[model samples]
Each structure stands twice: as C-alpha cells, then as structure tokens.
Target: MTVWDRPEPPARPVPLDRERIVAAAIALADEGGLEAVSLRKVAARLNAGPMRLYGYISAKQELFDLMTDEVYAEILPEERPCEWREALRVLAHRTRRAALRHEWLADLLGGRPSLGPNGLAVTEAKLAALHGLADIDTVLRAVETVSSYATGAIRREIASRRAERATGLSERDWQRASGAHVTRMLATGRFPALASAVHDGADVDAETTFATGLEWVLDAVAARLTRPPA
Candidate 1:
C-alpha cells in the first residue's frame, strides 16, 4: 500500500482523564525506578509531548500523589471483622502486599498524606475500623502505630534489597553481617543473657522482625481498647 493509501496508520487513542495519566505513571514507576519516571518519560510512553501530560497532571508531585493514592487504592476493604485482632491482621497483610508490589511505595507512603479521593477513602476505612476504640487519642495512636509498622517493614525491606545490590551480596552472604562477627563477640560469654540468646539461635530476619513488631503494636492497641474510659 502506498503511504497515503495506508489510511494514516490508524490514529491511536489519547487519554483525557487524570486516572489514565496516573495509571500510566504508576506502570512507568513500577517498571523503572522513581527517577526513571518523568513527564518526558510518561509522554514518550503515551506517544505524546511532555506538555500534553501537564494538561492531565499539573506537576510531577501531583503525578506522584496520584500514583501514591493508586497504590493505596489497592487495599481491600472489607467491613472490619468483629475482633480487632482479625481486622489488624488483614490490614497489615494488605498494606504489606501493596508495599511489596510497588518498590517506590514506602517513601510515598510516609510522605505528606494525599488528599485525593482515593487516599481519603483508605483513611476513612482505617478510621472506621478503629472507631470502636471511641477515644480520639486512642484511635489516632492506633492509626499511627499500624501505619508506622507497615512503612517501617517496607522501608527495611527496600534498604536490605539495596544494600545487597550495592555490596553484591546474597541472602546467604547476609548471615555474615552479624553472623561470625557478632556471634564471636557473644561467644566470649561475658554476658550470660547474650550467651543464652546466641546459643538459642538469635538470627535476625526482616520478615520475622517485622511480624514480631507488628504483633506487639496490635497487642498494645488491644490493651488500649480494653482500658476503661477515663
């Protein structure tokens, strides 16, 4: 077919909504590091100019905010079960999954809260789940506690991954960190508690440490719930 007979190669559709642009940005961020995401990159992905992206998203920060909300939007919302422990367990797993799925999410999560509708929806869901606490102070503390745990877990995971990449170390090699080094220090038997703990096997695991801390926080929240109203 001649160039003109090709019927202009079928014009591709253009996205006109913020959701579409933000979705594109999310996909871009997922495949590449956050630094690889930019108006220019997104535009090129969409086969448009950088200025066209601004039409849908005002600034890169706005794009990031939208992407952040999109990640939170993945949180599954079920009416919190009757037991607070069950609710917390579900929420923690959901948050962990979202963070693990999106590598850039930990930083986005701890940054300024997004006021977008999707973000507000997630916040409202969390508040409602903790509404049984009835005390504003307790409720706020519970929210903050769980959120910090989730973010801290994700942050540690990311840091560990980065450290491994930088040092060309694998998990097997990771044991070398406090392995022989700390083990030898404890082997001196200067402190009975240290010796006992080392003999009992005191290996550190990111997942185990995270779950232990999360369980402790939830237990604290449960204690607060049972406390008599002042």
Candidate 2:
C-alpha cells in the first residue's frame, strides 16, 4: 500500500514496567487481599493482556516480592537514628507502621529473603546501625532476632485487628463477653494464672503492647552486645 493509503500503526500501548506492574498488584491486594491479586487481574488493571505481565514478572510469587519491596521503601527511615538502639527501634516501628498501612504485608513480611534494591537498603541500614558494636555473627543475630520479633508482632497485630473487625468487638470485650464459655472456664480455677491475668492485668492498647515488647527485646539484645550504644 502507498504511504498515504497505509493504515496508521496502532497507538503504542501504555508503557509497562516493573513499577507499574507492582503498583497494580499492590492496589489489587489493598482493595481485596493477597488472594485477590493475580496476573490476569493486574494485567486487566493496566489495560494489557495477562501474557504481557510475563515480561515484568514471571510468577505470582515474584509479583508479591515486588510488592513487598515497594512497601519496604516506605519503611526506610527519613533520617536514620545515630544510636544503634534507636536505629533498630525506629526500623521496627516503621516496619510495623508499614505493615499496618498495607495489611497484606502481614502475610509476606520476612516470608522470603528481600533482595530488591529497596529491601537491601533496609537491611543495610539495620546493619550499618550496628556496624562496630560486635562481631559480624553477633550483629547478624541481633538483627535477625529483632526482625523476628517485629514480624511476629506485626502479624499478630494484623490478625487481632482482623478478628476485631470480624466480631465487631475489641479484643478484651471479645475475650470477656463474646463467649460465656470463656467466663465459665475462667471461673473454674483450673487455670489460675490465666484467670488472674485476664481479670487483673491492665488492658493496654496494641501500640503500647507492641512497643513494650519491642523494648524488652532490645534490652535483651543490648545485654548481648559487645559494645554498648553511645
């Protein structure tokens, strides 16, 4: 066909990249949940075919990894603390806050090794905070311990929040009033320590509980450190 008669090439498809793919996946997860995210759904969100996504992510798990790393960017501190303890504490809190914001993160936090750029940056920050405090082994152990606590805490917090939403009751109310079975069990005195804790323990908010537990973990780490934080 002559140049003038030739059909114009179809408009170029909107640019696609890892960022866009991950963003679409994250949006899907946020609206529904991780289970809601799929390559077809993400591709649909981007006005592309599912096969097109293969160029950016080979599998669903890879998409999840990208989403997790993207969230890690939010966990990176704006200004890292100078003190190692404060640095670790900040990282833990920021990670918790990030998980809270992206509730699906509870499902994926520490699920896999984070090798993405942003993820590595987070690890580097944590390691840098304890650069000279001890031998490499000890530092690695401290980081892993603190990270494990934070991951477990965040997951529990998310699970509790989900339970609260499902029951339309706060945790304490759910435990104390939602079930007569619990009350009967508590009164049986078979579990004296449990009963006492349930009846007499001060009811603290989730943030306070998390912070207190984190401090305890930090204290334990401090005890093991070869050099104390300045």
How do the predictions measure up, each by TM-score?
Answer: 0.81, 0.90
181-207, model 2: which lDDT tens digit per residue?
Answer: 977888888999988887799989889
Q: Which ten residues in a row are the worst by lDDT in model 2?
A: 1-10
lDDT of 1 by residue, 156-198 (tens): 8887877788888886787666598877777677777877875
Q: Each model's C-alpha lDDT?
A: 0.74, 0.87
Count clashes in each candidate, considering only residues at least 3 apart in sequence or on different chains. Answer: 0, 0
lDDT of 1: 0.74
- TM-score (C-alpha, index-matched) for candidate 1: 0.81
Q: What is the C-alpha RMSD of each candidate to the true structure, in Å?
A: 8.1, 7.5
Which parts of model 2 have CA positions greater than 4 angstroms off? 1-12, 226-230
